[model samples]
Target: MTATGTGTTSTLHADAVRTLTDWRPADQDQEQLRLDYLAHLAEQPEGVYRSCLPAHLTASAAVIDPAAGRVLLTLHPKVGMWLQMGGHCEPGDADLASAALREAVEESGIPDLTLLRENGAPVPAKLDRHQVRCTGKDRPENTHLDVQYIALAPAGAQALISEESLDLRWFDFDRLPELTDHSVRDLVARARRLTA
Candidate 1:
């Protein structure tokens, strides 16, 4: 849970953090742009320049159980909402898939997870738009070009549930609780279709 010099701050285990930090996608264009923009913002001092910069950036991973018709989800602490396991992409990570896998293993405690990709090839995932709750004087806007992937777990896989989550379980598609986040529901549906 110690903070790495790379700016990732989380209470998850050190191995989890290291695994995610080491992830790298096959393509380098988008990764390069993110690094360049982040560097630009970092070099500017706190002033008018910093005020105009974007405040939120992140990535996520979806873990689906095809045979059981279920998906693993965590009830997040910050929003008290159920969500897929993921977080901000760290510097030096190669791509989103690695990040997603790392997050999945950390949050779910499922070590034998495999990422679902198209034709056994790495295709770039589409951008996903999301919103964050207003924090009093700070109405922070959040958007992420999530590299969505379908990941499969063996039946009866148990989740180790991290401190970041209030609860963790595999919920059947038809038995999913009423989720407050629409994107989460959409992701579940998409994952089901892809795996089926």
Candidate 2:
């Protein structure tokens, strides 16, 4: 993957492009496209074709207060949406989990946090796949592979809004704001079901 000041980009071979274009949206089509794209890259001759695909790594904390039935959320500026705390995965990070932990700490002032996974493990999963239009000038066709995880934070923690966010607060599930992104709402629903 190659990323410039504008955005990241990735190139696919003719066959890969054809496959991606021919794919029909289905429950498994998303995963199939990802696999095909990865395989296409694996078969490419090194240095011949440079990819500008951006690796988007995000970590979301399910700051749940079971008694209060509330979860922490942030209002993002770019999308003007209220969602979990996460951002792009940076280089030399321990892993995606570490990136999530770092973002949660930076966005919210909760110093003490615990990441919860099935069986109390830290294993990562392919939460979902998305095709986002590039906002950068270099490559306008760039898309993101968003990796999501569930984390836990202490109750009544004060949030420290960074420049990336407009506001932050703990919201009840039933009282969630009018979200601009359907994917984010899906994540919230999934998290609620899992936590409940």
Candidate 3:
């Protein structure tokens, strides 16, 4: 498994190129996004690391408890939606999966989460490209090329709301919030299937 947030991009392009080469996106849209991310990486070199520009790479996680009966979600402060835990990539992240796991642990406050794997490789189930709200002077509105992963949360794992989130809660797989968007629902379904 890739170590947690220990590999920084050698020249701003190395990390993104390396991680994308290893990732296997699950659908057509995802495949196209991967190519777009690669193009972005090639063009900007720093695209994989920045979050405040026109387009930047981001990582996120869909966390499921052991039985897959529940999913951990956060009321995102910027989006105001009960969504999966994730955010911009950090320089310390070893790979995309590591970045997702790091965000999961931080946002969900679950200390013992692990990435869901198949055939001994990290399983990246989906990709999301969405517009982000401009919430800070340095964080102007932009699109995030979000790499999504599924993670397993140990039984009885507790959640703590970080300053970035308004609240944190676990929703039964069958009962998500009204405002949870369609893409997130798809992510939940995919996570359930992949982790099952």
> Which of the numbered candidates is closest to the native, going by highest TM-score?
3
lDDT of 2 at 129: 51
Q: How many clashes (backbone N, Cα, C below 3 Å) per candidate?
A: 5, 6, 3
Runs of candidate 3 with Cα error greater than 4 angstroms are 1-13, 134-140
Query: Which prediction has more favorable lDDT, 1 or 2?
Result: 1
Q: List the residue pairs that clash in candidate 1.
A: 23-94, 24-94, 24-95, 25-94, 25-95
lDDT of 3: 0.79
TM-scores for all candidates: the values are 0.66, 0.66, 0.87
Candidate 1 TM-score, C-alpha based: 0.66
Residue 27 lDDT, candidate 3, scale 0-100 = 80
* Index of the highest-lDDT prediction: 3
Error of 1 at 85 (Å): 1.1
Give all candidate RMSDs, comma-separated.
8.1, 7.9, 3.6
Cα shift from native, residue 153, model 3 (Å): 0.3
Clashing pairs in 2: 2-51, 2-52, 8-52, 9-52, 9-53, 10-52
Across 1-196, the per-residue lDDT of candidate 2 in tens digits comes to: 4322122322223322343344343357456745645554355422112233543323345455544667678887755678777766444343456666777777776778666566555533334455544455454554454445556666665666677678888888678788736666665665676667
Compared with the true structure, what per-residue lDDT tens digits does model 1 show for residues 39-59? 433452221111323433345
**With candidate 2 superimposed using the best TM-score fit, by how many Å does residue 44's alpha carbon deviate from the native?**
9.6
